[model samples]
Target: MENTGSFYNRLTLQALAIVEGESDLIANLSNISALLNMELENINWVGFYLLKNDELVLGPFQGKPACVRIPVGKGVCGTAVKDNRVMRIDDVHAFPGHIACDAVSQSEIVIPLNIGEKCIGVLDIDSPDLSRFDQNDEQGLVSFVTELQKVL
Candidate 1:
């Protein structure tokens, strides 16, 4: 297996390549979600939720359908946006105000997508296995989001 750092390095490069010339936001986010679905193992859902009108609206995703809207500061995704930080829950069930879009999702990670000081959206990933994400995954995804911010 590839080391986490190397794996994310490649993933970030691939993401950059994929969105290189694409100027459309939805198209880029859709493709990114697809790319994550194909590369990340043990993940059941990968997607983005864009901030709109003080709430998060589902942007693009891979997996079963998810909640369409989340109020800022409400659920995991919302809290990430409200706090402007990444939320990595090893066990979603224990997380207060965790909105269960999928009951099968045992673990989750939400990375707030920011441009300067304003948060635009979030990259949300879900897994069925407990403790599916660790510090490495968090750092890697944070790096991924950092690069993604440049393109968007």
Candidate 2:
């Protein structure tokens, strides 16, 4: 198994290449979601939630269908956006106001996407294993999003 450092390095390089010469938001998000879904192990869901009309609307994802909209300050995704910070929930059931988009999702990590100071959307990843995400994962995904933001 690849370590987090290497995994993320590879992910970043690939993501950069994927977005090269592609300026379309939806197309880039679709590819990013697909890349994360394909590269990450043990993840049940991978997607993007775009900020629209003061709420998060599902953008592109790979997995089962997910919630269509989430209000700011509600659920993990909303909370991440509301606080403009990254949220790594080890156990979704224990998270207050947790939205159960996937019944089997036990852990989740939400990375708020920002262009300069403006919050545009978020990158959400879900896993079936409890405590699936760690500090390393958080940092790694944050780096991934940082690179992703340049093309958005």
Candidate 3:
């Protein structure tokens, strides 16, 4: 298998190319999911929860069964969407009202994906290691999301 960052670097470039070509959103999301699973090391889950209508519905993901419906202000994922900011949790258990989709997950980083200045979805990543994400990830994810929004 490819090294984690190497995988993300490859896929991120691919996604950028697709965005430049104005390709499909669903296909883009699917590729993102695959990239997260393949690029991020020791991750239990990585995917998106897209806001549709008024609720957050599950989008393309690379993991086991996840919570299908998340309200506007529920778990870490929900709270991120509701707050419209990145929520980086070193320990999910410590976060109040954290919805435990997988008990094995220790840390999580959720970035709100915005389009046209509207919060449309969330990019969520989970890892089994404590403090799996940091400022670097936050910056990298922000850049990635910025790139993603160009065509969405």
Estimate TM-scores for all models.
0.98, 0.97, 0.88
- TM-score, candidate 2, is 0.97
Where is the poorest 10-residue window by lDDT in model 1? 112-121
Question: What is the C-alpha local distance difference test score of candidate 3?
Answer: 0.85
The pairs that clash in candidate 3 are: none
- Against the true structure, whose TM-score is highest? 1
What TM-score number comes out for model 3?
0.88
- What digit string (tens of lDDT, one per residue) describes model 1 on residues 27-52? 99999999999999999999999999
- TM-score attained by model 1: 0.98
Off by over 4 Å in 2: none
lDDT of 2 by residue, 1-152 (tens): 78889999899999999989988989989998999999998999999999998899999999999999999999999999999999999999999999999999999999999998899889999999999999999999999899878777
Candidate 1 residue runs with Cα over 4 Å from true position: none
The lowest-lDDT stretch of 10 consecutive residues in candidate 2 is 143-152
Q: Sorted by lDDT, highest first, which candidate order results?
A: 1, 2, 3
The sequence of per-residue lDDT tens digits that candidate 3 reaches over residues 50-138 is 99977889999999889998898999988998889899999999999999989999999999988898998899999999999887777
Clashes of 3: 0
Q: Tell me how many clashing residue pairs each candidate has.
A: 0, 0, 0
